[model samples]
Target: MNQHILNVKRRTSLVTVFTLILSVQLGFIAYSGELKSRVPPDQLQEAQSLKNPYSVTKEFVDKGRILYEGRAFCSVCHGRDGQGLPVGPDYDSSSQPLPTNFTDGAWQTARSDGEIFWILKNGSHGTDMAAFMPQYVSEKEAWQLVTYLRSFQGA
Candidate 1:
Protein backbone atom coordinates (compact mmCIF):
# COMPACT_ATOMS: atom_id res chain seq x y z
CA MET A 1 0.00 0.00 0.00
CA ASN A 2 2.85 2.39 0.87
CA GLN A 3 4.56 1.65 -2.47
CA HIS A 4 1.35 2.44 -4.37
CA ILE A 5 1.04 5.76 -2.53
CA LEU A 6 4.64 6.62 -3.35
CA ASN A 7 4.07 5.89 -7.05
CA VAL A 8 1.03 8.16 -7.10
CA LYS A 9 2.98 10.95 -5.44
CA ARG A 10 5.77 10.58 -7.98
CA ARG A 11 3.29 10.73 -10.85
CA THR A 12 1.73 13.89 -9.41
CA SER A 13 5.13 15.52 -9.10
CA LEU A 14 5.93 14.73 -12.71
CA VAL A 15 2.65 16.24 -13.92
CA THR A 16 3.24 19.37 -11.87
CA VAL A 17 6.70 19.80 -13.34
CA PHE A 18 5.41 19.27 -16.87
CA THR A 19 2.62 21.79 -16.37
CA LEU A 20 5.06 24.41 -15.14
CA ILE A 21 7.34 23.90 -18.12
CA LEU A 22 4.47 24.10 -20.58
CA SER A 23 3.14 27.26 -18.95
CA VAL A 24 6.50 28.93 -19.14
CA GLN A 25 6.85 28.10 -22.83
CA LEU A 26 3.43 29.48 -23.63
CA GLY A 27 4.07 32.60 -21.61
CA PHE A 28 7.29 33.13 -23.48
CA ILE A 29 5.52 32.78 -26.79
CA ALA A 30 3.01 35.45 -25.76
CA TYR A 31 5.60 37.79 -24.26
CA SER A 32 8.11 37.32 -27.08
CA GLY A 33 5.46 38.68 -29.50
CA GLU A 34 5.66 35.68 -31.80
CA LEU A 35 1.95 34.95 -31.46
CA LYS A 36 0.91 38.52 -32.22
CA SER A 37 2.87 38.50 -35.50
CA ARG A 38 4.12 42.08 -35.52
CA VAL A 39 7.05 44.20 -34.53
CA PRO A 40 7.59 44.98 -30.89
CA PRO A 41 6.04 47.98 -29.07
CA ASP A 42 5.62 51.42 -30.71
CA GLN A 43 6.50 50.26 -34.21
CA LEU A 44 3.01 48.91 -34.70
CA GLN A 45 1.57 52.06 -33.16
CA GLU A 46 3.53 54.26 -35.58
CA ALA A 47 2.62 52.13 -38.54
CA GLN A 48 -1.03 52.23 -37.57
CA SER A 49 -1.11 56.02 -37.37
CA LEU A 50 -0.37 56.73 -41.01
CA LYS A 51 -3.43 58.47 -42.40
CA ASN A 52 -5.00 57.63 -45.74
CA PRO A 53 -5.33 60.47 -48.21
CA TYR A 54 -8.83 59.32 -49.06
CA SER A 55 -11.78 60.76 -47.19
CA VAL A 56 -14.06 58.90 -44.78
CA THR A 57 -17.68 59.60 -45.73
CA LYS A 58 -21.04 57.98 -46.26
CA GLU A 59 -20.30 57.73 -49.96
CA PHE A 60 -17.07 55.99 -49.11
CA VAL A 61 -19.00 53.59 -46.91
CA ASP A 62 -21.30 52.83 -49.81
CA LYS A 63 -18.37 52.16 -52.04
CA GLY A 64 -16.83 50.00 -49.35
CA ARG A 65 -20.08 48.10 -49.09
CA ILE A 66 -19.97 47.35 -52.77
CA LEU A 67 -16.37 46.27 -52.61
CA TYR A 68 -16.88 44.17 -49.49
CA GLU A 69 -19.93 42.47 -50.91
CA GLY A 70 -18.79 42.13 -54.49
CA ARG A 71 -15.08 42.30 -55.17
CA ALA A 72 -13.63 41.71 -51.73
CA PHE A 73 -16.15 38.96 -50.99
CA CYS A 74 -15.74 39.55 -47.24
CA SER A 75 -19.35 38.72 -46.46
CA VAL A 76 -18.96 35.05 -47.32
CA CYS A 77 -16.47 34.65 -44.52
CA HIS A 78 -17.18 37.50 -42.12
CA GLY A 79 -20.94 37.45 -42.57
CA ARG A 80 -23.04 40.45 -43.66
CA ASP A 81 -23.30 41.74 -40.07
CA GLY A 82 -19.64 41.15 -39.24
CA GLN A 83 -20.74 38.55 -36.68
CA GLY A 84 -18.20 36.14 -38.19
CA LEU A 85 -18.89 32.66 -39.53
CA PRO A 86 -18.02 29.32 -37.98
CA VAL A 87 -16.55 28.10 -41.26
CA GLY A 88 -13.47 30.11 -40.32
CA PRO A 89 -11.96 30.45 -36.84
CA ASP A 90 -12.55 33.76 -35.12
CA TYR A 91 -10.10 36.20 -36.67
CA ASP A 92 -9.27 37.23 -33.13
CA SER A 93 -8.90 33.69 -31.87
CA SER A 94 -5.45 33.09 -30.42
CA SER A 95 -5.34 29.71 -32.21
CA GLN A 96 -6.33 29.30 -35.88
CA PRO A 97 -7.91 32.71 -35.42
CA LEU A 98 -10.94 33.59 -37.52
CA PRO A 99 -11.99 36.99 -38.82
CA THR A 100 -12.67 39.80 -36.36
CA ASN A 101 -16.16 40.28 -35.04
CA PHE A 102 -16.78 43.96 -35.62
CA THR A 103 -19.82 43.78 -33.36
CA ASP A 104 -17.75 43.41 -30.20
CA GLY A 105 -17.85 46.79 -28.46
CA ALA A 106 -14.93 46.05 -26.19
CA TRP A 107 -12.75 45.12 -29.12
CA GLN A 108 -13.83 48.15 -31.13
CA THR A 109 -13.06 50.39 -28.21
CA ALA A 110 -9.56 49.04 -27.92
CA ARG A 111 -8.62 49.44 -31.60
CA SER A 112 -8.05 52.72 -33.38
CA ASP A 113 -9.31 53.62 -36.83
CA GLY A 114 -5.84 53.75 -38.28
CA GLU A 115 -4.92 50.41 -36.71
CA ILE A 116 -7.96 48.79 -38.26
CA PHE A 117 -7.04 50.24 -41.63
CA TRP A 118 -3.51 48.90 -41.39
CA ILE A 119 -4.71 45.41 -40.52
CA LEU A 120 -7.08 45.52 -43.48
CA LYS A 121 -4.27 46.54 -45.78
CA ASN A 122 -1.57 44.26 -44.43
CA GLY A 123 -3.60 41.26 -43.35
CA SER A 124 -2.76 39.06 -40.36
CA HIS A 125 -0.14 36.38 -40.92
CA GLY A 126 -1.11 34.04 -38.08
CA THR A 127 -4.68 33.84 -39.30
CA ASP A 128 -6.55 33.07 -42.51
CA MET A 129 -7.20 36.75 -43.29
CA ALA A 130 -5.25 37.94 -46.28
CA ALA A 131 -3.93 41.26 -47.54
CA PHE A 132 -5.99 40.91 -50.74
CA MET A 133 -8.42 43.45 -49.27
CA PRO A 134 -6.03 46.22 -50.21
CA GLN A 135 -5.45 44.74 -53.65
CA TYR A 136 -9.11 45.16 -54.43
CA VAL A 137 -10.11 48.26 -52.46
CA SER A 138 -8.53 51.65 -52.86
CA GLU A 139 -7.11 53.40 -49.82
CA LYS A 140 -10.25 55.48 -49.70
CA GLU A 141 -12.42 52.40 -49.91
CA ALA A 142 -10.54 50.76 -47.06
CA TRP A 143 -11.04 53.79 -44.84
CA GLN A 144 -14.72 53.70 -45.66
CA LEU A 145 -14.83 50.10 -44.59
CA VAL A 146 -13.30 51.18 -41.32
CA THR A 147 -16.15 53.57 -40.73
CA TYR A 148 -18.72 50.94 -41.62
CA LEU A 149 -17.01 48.48 -39.30
CA ARG A 150 -17.25 50.96 -36.43
CA SER A 151 -21.00 50.94 -36.84
CA PHE A 152 -20.96 47.25 -36.06
CA GLN A 153 -19.60 47.81 -32.57
CA GLY A 154 -23.00 48.70 -31.19
CA ALA A 155 -24.97 46.31 -33.36
Candidate 2:
Protein backbone atom coordinates (compact mmCIF):
# COMPACT_ATOMS: atom_id res chain seq x y z
CA MET A 1 0.00 0.00 0.00
CA ASN A 2 2.79 2.46 0.82
CA GLN A 3 4.61 1.61 -2.45
CA HIS A 4 1.38 2.16 -4.38
CA ILE A 5 0.89 5.54 -2.67
CA LEU A 6 4.49 6.52 -3.44
CA ASN A 7 4.03 5.62 -7.11
CA VAL A 8 0.91 7.77 -7.34
CA LYS A 9 2.69 10.70 -5.73
CA ARG A 10 5.60 10.37 -8.10
CA ARG A 11 3.29 10.30 -11.10
CA THR A 12 1.46 13.35 -9.80
CA SER A 13 4.70 15.23 -9.36
CA LEU A 14 5.82 14.34 -12.88
CA VAL A 15 2.48 15.42 -14.27
CA THR A 16 2.71 18.74 -12.46
CA VAL A 17 6.18 19.37 -13.82
CA PHE A 18 5.05 18.56 -17.32
CA THR A 19 2.07 20.85 -17.01
CA LEU A 20 4.22 23.69 -15.79
CA ILE A 21 6.68 23.28 -18.65
CA LEU A 22 3.87 23.18 -21.16
CA SER A 23 2.28 26.27 -19.71
CA VAL A 24 5.53 28.19 -19.88
CA GLN A 25 6.07 27.17 -23.50
CA LEU A 26 2.60 28.28 -24.46
CA GLY A 27 3.02 31.57 -22.67
CA PHE A 28 6.34 32.22 -24.40
CA ILE A 29 4.84 31.46 -27.76
CA ALA A 30 2.04 33.90 -27.11
CA TYR A 31 4.34 36.57 -25.73
CA SER A 32 6.88 36.22 -28.52
CA GLY A 33 4.25 36.58 -31.22
CA GLU A 34 6.33 34.10 -33.11
CA LEU A 35 5.57 34.19 -36.80
CA LYS A 36 5.55 31.18 -39.07
CA SER A 37 7.39 31.13 -42.35
CA ARG A 38 5.55 32.46 -45.36
CA VAL A 39 7.38 30.19 -47.74
CA PRO A 40 5.48 27.20 -48.96
CA PRO A 41 6.72 23.84 -47.75
CA ASP A 42 7.47 22.58 -51.25
CA GLN A 43 9.99 25.37 -51.71
CA LEU A 44 11.06 25.77 -48.09
CA GLN A 45 14.23 23.72 -48.38
CA GLU A 46 15.52 25.58 -51.43
CA ALA A 47 14.47 28.93 -50.08
CA GLN A 48 16.18 28.43 -46.73
CA SER A 49 19.37 27.31 -48.44
CA LEU A 50 19.69 30.58 -50.36
CA LYS A 51 22.46 32.86 -49.15
CA ASN A 52 23.00 36.58 -49.74
CA PRO A 53 25.53 37.12 -52.45
CA TYR A 54 26.20 40.74 -51.63
CA SER A 55 28.13 41.64 -48.51
CA VAL A 56 26.34 43.47 -45.71
CA THR A 57 27.65 47.03 -45.67
CA LYS A 58 26.44 50.55 -45.04
CA GLU A 59 26.29 51.20 -48.78
CA PHE A 60 24.05 48.19 -49.42
CA VAL A 61 21.82 48.99 -46.48
CA ASP A 62 21.53 52.58 -47.69
CA LYS A 63 20.58 51.42 -51.16
CA GLY A 64 18.00 49.13 -49.67
CA ARG A 65 16.66 51.97 -47.54
CA ILE A 66 16.17 53.99 -50.69
CA LEU A 67 14.22 51.22 -52.35
CA TYR A 68 12.23 50.41 -49.24
CA GLU A 69 11.22 54.01 -48.57
CA GLY A 70 10.96 55.16 -52.16
CA ARG A 71 10.08 52.86 -55.01
CA ALA A 72 9.24 49.83 -52.90
CA PHE A 73 7.15 51.98 -50.57
CA CYS A 74 7.63 49.38 -47.84
CA SER A 75 7.59 52.12 -45.23
CA VAL A 76 3.96 52.78 -46.07
CA CYS A 77 2.90 49.53 -44.41
CA HIS A 78 5.98 48.43 -42.48
CA GLY A 79 6.50 51.92 -41.04
CA ARG A 80 9.72 53.90 -41.21
CA ASP A 81 10.75 52.38 -37.89
CA GLY A 82 10.08 48.82 -39.10
CA GLN A 83 7.55 48.29 -36.32
CA GLY A 84 4.68 47.84 -38.82
CA LEU A 85 1.81 50.23 -39.37
CA PRO A 86 -1.87 49.49 -39.14
CA VAL A 87 -3.50 48.71 -42.40
CA GLY A 88 -6.18 50.92 -43.85
CA PRO A 89 -9.78 50.39 -42.83
CA ASP A 90 -10.53 48.80 -46.16
CA TYR A 91 -8.10 45.99 -45.40
CA ASP A 92 -9.79 42.62 -45.11
CA SER A 93 -8.50 41.26 -41.86
CA SER A 94 -10.10 37.87 -42.47
CA SER A 95 -8.03 37.27 -45.54
CA GLN A 96 -4.70 38.88 -44.77
CA PRO A 97 -2.45 39.03 -41.75
CA LEU A 98 -0.85 42.23 -40.53
CA PRO A 99 2.48 43.51 -41.75
CA THR A 100 5.41 42.04 -39.84
CA ASN A 101 7.29 44.08 -37.26
CA PHE A 102 10.94 43.88 -38.22
CA THR A 103 12.02 45.20 -34.88
CA ASP A 104 10.82 41.96 -33.31
CA GLY A 105 14.12 40.29 -32.48
CA ALA A 106 12.50 36.92 -31.96
CA TRP A 107 10.86 37.13 -35.35
CA GLN A 108 14.09 38.32 -36.93
CA THR A 109 15.96 35.39 -35.44
CA ALA A 110 13.25 32.98 -36.48
CA ARG A 111 13.29 33.92 -40.16
CA SER A 112 16.13 33.27 -42.55
CA ASP A 113 17.70 35.60 -45.10
CA GLY A 114 16.50 33.29 -47.86
CA GLU A 115 12.97 33.34 -46.54
CA ILE A 116 13.03 37.14 -46.75
CA PHE A 117 14.52 37.04 -50.24
CA TRP A 118 11.88 34.56 -51.29
CA ILE A 119 9.17 36.83 -49.97
CA LEU A 120 10.59 39.71 -52.02
CA LYS A 121 10.68 37.57 -55.12
CA ASN A 122 7.53 35.56 -54.63
CA GLY A 123 5.56 37.72 -52.22
CA SER A 124 4.06 36.41 -48.99
CA HIS A 125 1.33 33.88 -49.53
CA GLY A 126 -2.13 34.87 -48.24
CA THR A 127 -0.96 38.39 -47.40
CA ASP A 128 -0.99 41.79 -49.06
CA MET A 129 2.74 41.52 -49.73
CA ALA A 130 3.26 41.54 -53.48
CA ALA A 131 6.32 40.65 -55.46
CA PHE A 132 8.75 43.53 -55.81
CA MET A 133 11.45 41.69 -57.69
CA PRO A 134 11.51 41.98 -61.49
CA GLN A 135 8.93 44.73 -61.14
CA TYR A 136 10.27 47.48 -58.90
CA VAL A 137 13.59 46.02 -57.81
CA SER A 138 16.28 43.72 -59.14
CA GLU A 139 17.72 40.64 -57.45
CA LYS A 140 20.69 42.57 -56.13
CA GLU A 141 18.42 45.29 -54.80
CA ALA A 142 16.28 42.68 -53.08
CA TRP A 143 19.32 41.21 -51.33
CA GLN A 144 20.27 44.69 -50.23
CA LEU A 145 16.81 45.15 -48.84
CA VAL A 146 17.22 41.95 -46.83
CA THR A 147 20.43 43.35 -45.36
CA TYR A 148 18.64 46.57 -44.50
CA LEU A 149 15.89 44.61 -42.81
CA ARG A 150 18.47 43.03 -40.49
CA SER A 151 19.26 46.52 -39.25
CA PHE A 152 15.78 46.64 -37.76
CA GLN A 153 16.51 43.87 -35.26
CA GLY A 154 16.20 45.05 -31.62
CA ALA A 155 15.20 48.48 -32.86
Candidate 3:
Protein backbone atom coordinates (compact mmCIF):
# COMPACT_ATOMS: atom_id res chain seq x y z
CA MET A 1 0.00 0.00 0.00
CA ASN A 2 1.13 3.61 -0.55
CA GLN A 3 2.60 5.23 2.61
CA HIS A 4 -0.29 7.69 2.69
CA ILE A 5 -2.86 4.88 2.55
CA LEU A 6 -1.07 2.98 5.34
CA ASN A 7 -1.14 6.05 7.59
CA VAL A 8 -4.81 6.56 6.90
CA LYS A 9 -5.55 2.91 7.77
CA ARG A 10 -3.63 3.24 11.06
CA ARG A 11 -5.63 6.32 11.99
CA THR A 12 -8.90 4.58 11.16
CA SER A 13 -7.92 1.61 13.32
CA LEU A 14 -7.14 3.91 16.24
CA VAL A 15 -10.42 5.71 15.86
CA THR A 16 -12.34 2.42 15.80
CA VAL A 17 -10.62 1.21 18.97
CA PHE A 18 -11.28 4.49 20.75
CA THR A 19 -14.91 4.44 19.79
CA LEU A 20 -15.33 0.87 21.03
CA ILE A 21 -13.69 1.67 24.35
CA LEU A 22 -15.85 4.74 24.88
CA SER A 23 -19.03 2.86 24.10
CA VAL A 24 -18.14 0.09 26.53
CA GLN A 25 -17.37 2.57 29.27
CA LEU A 26 -20.63 4.37 28.75
CA GLY A 27 -22.51 1.07 28.77
CA PHE A 28 -20.96 -0.01 32.02
CA ILE A 29 -21.70 3.30 33.64
CA ALA A 30 -25.32 3.06 32.53
CA TYR A 31 -25.84 -0.48 33.84
CA SER A 32 -23.88 -0.10 37.06
CA GLY A 33 -27.08 0.50 39.06
CA GLU A 34 -29.94 -0.28 36.72
CA LEU A 35 -32.12 -1.62 39.49
CA LYS A 36 -35.16 0.11 40.96
CA SER A 37 -35.25 -1.35 44.46
CA ARG A 38 -33.16 -4.17 45.84
CA VAL A 39 -35.10 -4.31 49.11
CA PRO A 40 -37.20 -7.40 49.33
CA PRO A 41 -40.85 -7.21 50.20
CA ASP A 42 -40.37 -8.81 53.61
CA GLN A 43 -37.27 -6.80 54.40
CA LEU A 44 -38.90 -3.58 53.22
CA GLN A 45 -41.93 -4.38 55.31
CA GLU A 46 -39.66 -5.00 58.27
CA ALA A 47 -37.90 -1.70 57.77
CA GLN A 48 -41.24 -0.03 57.43
CA SER A 49 -42.26 -1.47 60.77
CA LEU A 50 -39.29 0.20 62.46
CA LYS A 51 -39.61 3.65 64.10
CA ASN A 52 -37.45 6.67 64.84
CA PRO A 53 -36.52 7.05 68.49
CA TYR A 54 -35.97 10.77 68.03
CA SER A 55 -39.04 12.93 68.19
CA VAL A 56 -39.92 15.26 65.30
CA THR A 57 -38.74 18.46 66.88
CA LYS A 58 -37.76 21.66 65.11
CA GLU A 59 -34.15 21.27 66.16
CA PHE A 60 -33.96 17.77 64.78
CA VAL A 61 -35.60 18.82 61.53
CA ASP A 62 -33.18 21.70 61.19
CA LYS A 63 -30.21 19.43 61.73
CA GLY A 64 -31.60 17.05 59.13
CA ARG A 65 -32.07 19.91 56.71
CA ILE A 66 -28.44 20.84 57.09
CA LEU A 67 -27.29 17.29 56.53
CA TYR A 68 -29.65 16.79 53.63
CA GLU A 69 -28.31 19.85 51.88
CA GLY A 70 -24.70 19.55 52.99
CA ARG A 71 -23.06 16.34 54.12
CA ALA A 72 -25.55 13.89 52.70
CA PHE A 73 -25.97 15.76 49.38
CA CYS A 74 -29.65 14.85 49.25
CA SER A 75 -30.86 18.27 48.25
CA VAL A 76 -29.05 18.17 44.89
CA CYS A 77 -31.47 15.65 43.47
CA HIS A 78 -34.26 15.57 46.02
CA GLY A 79 -34.21 19.36 46.03
CA ARG A 80 -33.85 21.64 49.08
CA ASP A 81 -37.57 21.25 49.55
CA GLY A 82 -37.34 17.40 49.68
CA GLN A 83 -39.40 16.99 46.55
CA GLY A 84 -37.67 14.85 43.91
CA LEU A 85 -35.89 16.67 41.09
CA PRO A 86 -35.88 15.53 37.48
CA VAL A 87 -32.41 14.42 36.48
CA GLY A 88 -31.26 12.32 33.53
CA PRO A 89 -30.88 8.54 33.82
CA ASP A 90 -27.18 9.17 34.30
CA TYR A 91 -24.94 8.61 37.28
CA ASP A 92 -25.89 10.48 40.48
CA SER A 93 -29.55 10.69 39.57
CA SER A 94 -32.42 9.64 41.82
CA SER A 95 -33.65 7.47 38.93
CA GLN A 96 -36.75 9.37 39.77
CA PRO A 97 -39.11 8.26 37.00
CA LEU A 98 -40.58 11.40 38.37
CA PRO A 99 -39.16 13.65 41.09
CA THR A 100 -40.21 11.58 44.08
CA ASN A 101 -42.35 14.41 45.34
CA PHE A 102 -42.40 14.30 49.13
CA THR A 103 -44.66 17.32 48.98
CA ASP A 104 -47.56 15.16 47.92
CA GLY A 105 -49.86 14.91 50.90
CA ALA A 106 -51.29 11.51 49.97
CA TRP A 107 -47.88 10.02 49.13
CA GLN A 108 -46.45 11.35 52.36
CA THR A 109 -49.26 9.82 54.34
CA ALA A 110 -48.91 6.52 52.52
CA ARG A 111 -45.27 5.89 53.37
CA SER A 112 -44.18 5.18 56.93
CA ASP A 113 -41.30 6.74 58.87
CA GLY A 114 -39.58 3.39 59.00
CA GLU A 115 -39.92 2.93 55.27
CA ILE A 116 -38.31 6.28 54.73
CA PHE A 117 -35.48 5.38 57.08
CA TRP A 118 -34.95 2.07 55.35
CA ILE A 119 -34.69 3.65 51.93
CA LEU A 120 -32.16 6.13 53.24
CA LYS A 121 -30.06 3.45 54.88
CA ASN A 122 -30.27 0.82 52.17
CA GLY A 123 -30.74 3.11 49.17
CA SER A 124 -33.36 2.79 46.50
CA HIS A 125 -32.08 0.43 43.83
CA GLY A 126 -31.69 1.63 40.22
CA THR A 127 -31.85 5.19 41.52
CA ASP A 128 -28.99 7.60 42.00
CA MET A 129 -29.82 7.73 45.70
CA ALA A 130 -26.99 5.60 46.93
CA ALA A 131 -27.22 4.03 50.35
CA PHE A 132 -26.41 6.65 52.97
CA MET A 133 -24.56 4.18 55.14
CA PRO A 134 -23.58 4.79 58.76
CA GLN A 135 -20.07 5.52 57.52
CA TYR A 136 -21.43 8.41 55.44
CA VAL A 137 -24.49 9.45 57.46
CA SER A 138 -24.84 8.02 60.95
CA GLU A 139 -27.96 6.14 61.98
CA LYS A 140 -29.15 9.03 64.14
CA GLU A 141 -28.64 11.52 61.31
CA ALA A 142 -30.50 9.29 58.88
CA TRP A 143 -33.44 9.20 61.24
CA GLN A 144 -33.22 12.93 61.55
CA LEU A 145 -33.62 13.37 57.79
CA VAL A 146 -36.53 11.02 57.93
CA THR A 147 -38.03 13.16 60.64
CA TYR A 148 -37.52 16.27 58.57
CA LEU A 149 -39.02 14.63 55.51
CA ARG A 150 -42.05 13.56 57.48
CA SER A 151 -42.55 16.90 59.16
CA PHE A 152 -42.01 18.74 55.89
CA GLN A 153 -44.91 16.85 54.35
CA GLY A 154 -47.53 19.57 54.50
CA ALA A 155 -45.26 22.26 53.14
Candidate 4:
Protein backbone atom coordinates (compact mmCIF):
# COMPACT_ATOMS: atom_id res chain seq x y z
CA MET A 1 0.00 0.00 0.00
CA ASN A 2 2.87 2.41 0.83
CA GLN A 3 4.62 1.73 -2.53
CA HIS A 4 1.42 2.31 -4.51
CA ILE A 5 0.82 5.64 -2.77
CA LEU A 6 4.39 6.79 -3.49
CA ASN A 7 4.05 5.97 -7.17
CA VAL A 8 0.77 7.84 -7.39
CA LYS A 9 2.34 10.89 -5.75
CA ARG A 10 5.24 10.88 -8.19
CA ARG A 11 2.92 10.67 -11.16
CA THR A 12 0.81 13.52 -9.86
CA SER A 13 3.88 15.71 -9.30
CA LEU A 14 5.15 15.04 -12.83
CA VAL A 15 1.75 15.82 -14.32
CA THR A 16 1.58 19.10 -12.44
CA VAL A 17 5.04 20.18 -13.60
CA PHE A 18 4.24 19.28 -17.20
CA THR A 19 0.97 21.18 -17.07
CA LEU A 20 2.69 24.31 -15.76
CA ILE A 21 5.26 24.23 -18.53
CA LEU A 22 2.56 23.75 -21.14
CA SER A 23 0.59 26.68 -19.80
CA VAL A 24 3.58 29.04 -19.94
CA GLN A 25 4.35 28.03 -23.51
CA LEU A 26 0.72 28.47 -24.51
CA GLY A 27 0.68 31.96 -22.99
CA PHE A 28 3.72 32.90 -25.04
CA ILE A 29 2.12 31.56 -28.20
CA ALA A 30 -1.13 33.44 -27.55
CA TYR A 31 0.77 36.68 -27.02
CA SER A 32 2.80 36.20 -30.18
CA GLY A 33 -0.33 35.60 -32.24
CA GLU A 34 -1.82 38.89 -31.11
CA LEU A 35 1.22 41.09 -31.77
CA LYS A 36 0.10 44.60 -32.66
CA SER A 37 1.59 48.04 -33.09
CA ARG A 38 2.57 49.72 -29.84
CA VAL A 39 2.46 53.23 -31.31
CA PRO A 40 -0.54 55.35 -30.49
CA PRO A 41 -3.13 55.75 -33.25
CA ASP A 42 -2.73 59.53 -33.34
CA GLN A 43 1.07 59.42 -33.72
CA LEU A 44 1.28 56.35 -35.93
CA GLN A 45 1.53 58.34 -39.13
CA GLU A 46 4.15 60.79 -37.80
CA ALA A 47 6.12 58.04 -36.09
CA GLN A 48 6.19 55.99 -39.28
CA SER A 49 7.35 59.00 -41.25
CA LEU A 50 10.25 59.85 -38.90
CA LYS A 51 13.66 58.72 -40.19
CA ASN A 52 17.07 58.07 -38.71
CA PRO A 53 19.42 60.93 -39.44
CA TYR A 54 22.64 59.08 -38.64
CA SER A 55 24.45 56.55 -40.80
CA VAL A 56 24.86 52.86 -39.85
CA THR A 57 28.54 52.96 -39.07
CA LYS A 58 30.51 50.85 -36.62
CA GLU A 59 31.22 53.87 -34.43
CA PHE A 60 27.50 54.66 -34.14
CA VAL A 61 26.67 51.06 -33.35
CA ASP A 62 29.33 51.08 -30.65
CA LYS A 63 27.86 54.22 -29.12
CA GLY A 64 24.41 52.70 -29.20
CA ARG A 65 25.81 49.55 -27.64
CA ILE A 66 27.21 51.57 -24.75
CA LEU A 67 23.84 53.23 -24.14
CA TYR A 68 21.86 49.99 -24.53
CA GLU A 69 24.12 48.01 -22.23
CA GLY A 70 25.05 50.80 -19.83
CA ARG A 71 22.95 53.89 -19.22
CA ALA A 72 19.77 52.74 -20.95
CA PHE A 73 20.08 49.27 -19.39
CA CYS A 74 18.08 47.80 -22.25
CA SER A 75 19.84 44.49 -21.83
CA VAL A 76 18.41 44.21 -18.33
CA CYS A 77 15.01 43.35 -19.82
CA HIS A 78 15.72 42.79 -23.52
CA GLY A 79 18.67 40.47 -22.83
CA ARG A 80 22.23 41.06 -24.00
CA ASP A 81 21.42 39.30 -27.27
CA GLY A 82 18.15 41.22 -27.70
CA GLN A 83 16.03 38.03 -27.56
CA GLY A 84 14.31 39.38 -24.40
CA LEU A 85 14.49 37.91 -20.92
CA PRO A 86 11.83 35.78 -19.27
CA VAL A 87 8.96 37.52 -17.52
CA GLY A 88 7.84 36.75 -13.99
CA PRO A 89 4.90 34.39 -13.36
CA ASP A 90 2.85 37.44 -12.42
CA TYR A 91 3.10 38.84 -15.96
CA ASP A 92 -0.28 39.99 -17.23
CA SER A 93 -0.51 39.88 -21.00
CA SER A 94 -3.62 42.06 -21.18
CA SER A 95 -1.80 45.01 -19.63
CA GLN A 96 1.92 44.32 -19.84
CA PRO A 97 3.27 43.00 -23.11
CA LEU A 98 6.41 40.93 -23.31
CA PRO A 99 9.76 42.41 -24.25
CA THR A 100 10.35 42.26 -27.98
CA ASN A 101 12.62 39.52 -29.29
CA PHE A 102 14.88 41.54 -31.53
CA THR A 103 16.47 38.37 -32.90
CA ASP A 104 13.26 37.41 -34.65
CA GLY A 105 13.63 38.15 -38.36
CA ALA A 106 9.91 38.59 -38.82
CA TRP A 107 9.76 41.13 -36.00
CA GLN A 108 12.77 43.04 -37.31
CA THR A 109 11.13 43.27 -40.72
CA ALA A 110 7.77 44.30 -39.36
CA ARG A 111 9.18 47.16 -37.23
CA SER A 112 10.37 50.13 -39.24
CA ASP A 113 13.35 52.25 -38.18
CA GLY A 114 11.07 55.21 -37.69
CA GLU A 115 8.71 53.19 -35.55
CA ILE A 116 11.61 52.02 -33.44
CA PHE A 117 12.84 55.57 -32.98
CA TRP A 118 9.34 56.61 -32.08
CA ILE A 119 9.22 53.89 -29.47
CA LEU A 120 12.47 55.12 -28.01
CA LYS A 121 11.27 58.70 -28.05
CA ASN A 122 7.70 58.15 -26.86
CA GLY A 123 7.83 54.75 -25.20
CA SER A 124 5.21 52.02 -25.64
CA HIS A 125 2.16 52.69 -23.50
CA GLY A 126 0.70 50.10 -21.10
CA THR A 127 4.01 48.21 -21.17
CA ASP A 128 7.21 48.19 -19.15
CA MET A 129 9.08 49.87 -22.00
CA ALA A 130 10.00 53.44 -21.05
CA ALA A 131 11.21 56.34 -23.15
CA PHE A 132 14.97 56.88 -22.98
CA MET A 133 15.61 59.73 -25.40
CA PRO A 134 16.39 63.23 -24.07
CA GLN A 135 16.80 61.75 -20.61
CA TYR A 136 18.94 58.61 -20.94
CA VAL A 137 20.11 59.21 -24.48
CA SER A 138 20.00 61.93 -27.14
CA GLU A 139 18.17 61.69 -30.47
CA LYS A 140 21.41 60.78 -32.29
CA GLU A 141 22.17 58.02 -29.79
CA ALA A 142 18.66 56.67 -30.20
CA TRP A 143 19.24 56.39 -33.93
CA GLN A 144 22.45 54.56 -33.21
CA LEU A 145 20.56 52.22 -30.92
CA VAL A 146 18.19 51.49 -33.76
CA THR A 147 21.15 50.59 -35.96
CA TYR A 148 22.52 48.30 -33.28
CA LEU A 149 19.05 46.73 -32.90
CA ARG A 150 19.03 45.92 -36.62
CA SER A 151 22.22 43.93 -36.16
CA PHE A 152 20.25 41.56 -33.93
CA GLN A 153 18.03 40.58 -36.86
CA GLY A 154 18.29 36.88 -37.86
CA ALA A 155 20.73 36.44 -34.97
TM-score of each: 0.66, 0.75, 0.65, 0.74
- Evaluate model 4: give its lDDT: 0.87
Clashes of each: 4, 0, 3, 0
Candidate 3 per-residue C-alpha lDDT over 1-155 given as tens digits, one digit per residue, 9 for 90 to 100: 69999999999999999999999998886654333234667697687779888777889888988898898888787788767776555744443444467787866766788877887788776555678877688999998888878766788
The most accurate candidate by lDDT is 2
Residue runs of model 3 more than 4 Å from their true location after superposition: 1-39, 87-96
User: Judged by TM-score, which candidate is best?
Assistant: 2
RMSD from true fold, candidate 1: 5.8
Runs off by more than 4 Å, candidate 4: 1-34
For model 2, how does the per-residue alpha-carbon lDDT over 41-150 read when each residue is reduced to its tens digit?
Answer: 89999999999988888898999999888989999999999999977799886566788899988889989999999999999866789999989899999998999999
Question: Arrange candidates by lDDT, highest first: which order?
Answer: 2, 4, 3, 1
Candidate 3 backbone overlaps, count: 3
lDDT at 77, model 1: 83
Worst 10 residues of 2 by lDDT: 29-38
Q: List model 1 lDDT by residue over 76-121, tens digit each.
A: 8888888887763434455675666778776787677777777777
> Between the candidate structures 2 and 3, which one is better when assessed by TM-score?
2
lDDT of each: 0.73, 0.90, 0.76, 0.87
Better of 1 and 2 by lDDT: 2
Candidates sorted on TM-score, descending:
2, 4, 1, 3
